[model samples]
Target: MTEQSAPGTDRLSSVATAARILREFGKHSTQLGVSQLARRVGVNKSTTHRIIWTLVDEGLLERVEETGLFRLTTTMRSLGASAETAQRLHEAATTPLDELRRYTAGTLHVAILDGTDVLYVERREGPGAIPVFRSVGSRNAAHATSTGKVLLAFLPAERQARLVEGMRLSPKTSRTITSRPEFLAELQRVRRQGYAENRGESEPGMCSVAAPIRDPLGQVVASVSVAEQVESVDAGLRHLVAPIVETAARISSGLGWNR
Candidate 1:
């Protein structure tokens, strides 16, 4: 038996709900009330109430004191700065991605972390590239993708724990790491090795490797990945390591990461 505690399903469920509630704010210009947030996110009012208060406690939101509405705090504004970074990250990765595509003849992707998911911001298919059923705006669970694992492995420990624990780790394939301990261990390996790999974890027959892209502050902000369809999970992985790492380093340097 796994003895992992239903993998804390509700813990992550609530987290995902909180994320949805927060995103609803982006669609509006003013402060929002619990009822409106509930209606928009399709959650009951009471649950939305708790989630908002939790966000308030976390300092991402602030209560209006008199009107009982909630507004984003300065903390959120600081976090929102990443949106600009995302644009720059896209620009930074473009030339590197083009080079990687020509060099590897595989599908290349660049992604940014968004809550528990890795949002694909750019995708390119080289000659003989494998078809990965995702696009510029599509998203995938971080636990399942090489790009997502790279992002997760580089996150601050406390925030990483919160996110990894909250994730359900549902199996996407026979090799998916559905156990939290196992997944954490894998992340450790990824961090130590400075890259991450997917051996048909996200989809059968698809294998990928990714490396982290860091900003000027040396914080990892995105990942560059290349994937191919292979007969075995291990096929070509050894050769991919250096080239993918080189590609990521180039992209990171373009973003002003010195190391």
Candidate 2:
């Protein structure tokens, strides 16, 4: 019992020390030596070495091979940006999504991609609209939704390849793109068109149109979609993709996206 508990305690202590090191980096400049980090975290150099190397191996911190100092990598910035972007997206999208709800008289959603899944972060339903089968904090396959396509379509090519290299594109409906080559083609078209559409692909009687939400850096960080029962969408409204796209642009601009 003592041996088992001792290891757990040590692991917890190491974790706490690692967190302190990261915090110290944030408090000061980005670059710091291991010795500086150890002193800042109030730990001895050996323990600091263990913690720093662990974080380095995990890509949370990167070691400058020449300077032998550490700095936060793009991976770290990307993670932080993703969280901040999500918070800002939620705040900026609420009013716009509400307005979209009034315009479409349907369900609306804001989503982000988490690995191969679309994670719904916000949702609204119009009065008298059919209840969507999704909600905040729910996740579904990225291949099955317009929101997911908008998110996936803007991913860097290498990242996209990494995600779908060996993925099994399962069919959610007969209209779902189940072949990798076909899905890739679809994503290309979505990227060119600046939006994505799902016509009974995710749900048999449901249709959705989505546009990408970009951040200040012009990175696609989220998506907004208007969904409705296929029969309920007016034919004229189906051609009015501008409203949804414009609403997404409004939210993106609120998040500091220029142009």
Candidate 3:
């Protein structure tokens, strides 16, 4: 009788087999042969062939010069480099983030644009931190937060346009910008002002101000923001711009951004 598996077991096993095959590459060799990999991973030659081609299509692996040998691609190297850079970015932001939170008496955030969402990577809470943003590893809509706006504002024009074109523009509050044309105009204003604002866009009575953090190449890699729940949010967030911009600059400098 054929062995039975639960629903989706075949897909899960394929994924796990693919992962095992990938791990096998660096352990004993840089380039692997299909038959050799199949023997090592204990998968059938046919299944291993299918998974290897899938990885090749995804640019994770490439065949070696008309040979059966397969090796990891530059895409794998880039993915590894990105992981290291993300760690360095958090380390570079720490002292500046703490100082900014203390100086401004507001909760500080460091975020990156993740797809159409803003992924919060670091946070320092002051006494005035808003109740809604108490966690560091949370994600929020990109169109409804200051950090998201600042990161989006600094993106290259064509890429930014494409991203905006694909956005759903879902609203979190009445103050959120939900129109593509108006959102594009807002990004233009942010580019001119060199900062962005959130006036109760993500949460009721919450306000924030944000500026871009650059890498060594002067490309915007992240954003820093000061957020709080204020009674008079519109005017209250203005003063934070100076300190937020300065702190962002300090973090950028720490990351070796000279321009």
Instruction: Give the TM-scores of the predictions, in the order they appear.
Output: 0.70, 0.78, 0.77
Best by lDDT: 3
Per-residue lDDT tens digits for candidate 1, residues 1-259, read 7757675564777888988888877775458999999998899999999999999999888988888898889778667776777788788888888877546777888898989999887788766655454578788889999999999999999999999989989999998899999999999999999999999998888888999998899899899888888788856366788988998999989999897
Which residue pairs in candidate 3 have backbone atoms (N, alpha carbon, C) closer than 3 angstroms, thus clashing?
A: none
lDDT of 3 by residue, 1-259 (tens): 7689777766778888989988887685889999999999998999999999999999889999977699989878666656766797799998888777556777888888888888788888887667777687788888889988988999999999999999989888888899899999999999999999999989988899999999999999999988887897667599778888998999999899985
Ranking by TM-score: 2, 3, 1
Order the candidate numbers by lDDT, best to worst. Answer: 3, 1, 2
Relative to the true structure, candidate 2 reaches a TM of 0.78
| Candidate 2 Cα errors over 4 Å, as ranges | 1-12, 57-59, 73-75, 125-133, 155-165, 232-240
Note each model's CA RMSD in angstroms: 12.0, 4.7, 5.5
Q: What is candidate 2's lDDT per residue for 86-136, written digit by digit as tens?
A: 788889998888777547787788899988999888888655454444578
**Poorly placed runs, candidate 3 (over 4 Å):** 1-81
> Which candidate would rank higher by TM-score, 1 or 3?
3
* Worst-scoring 10-residue span by lDDT in model 3: 77-86
lDDT of each: 0.86, 0.82, 0.87
Candidate achieving higher lDDT, 1 or 2: 1
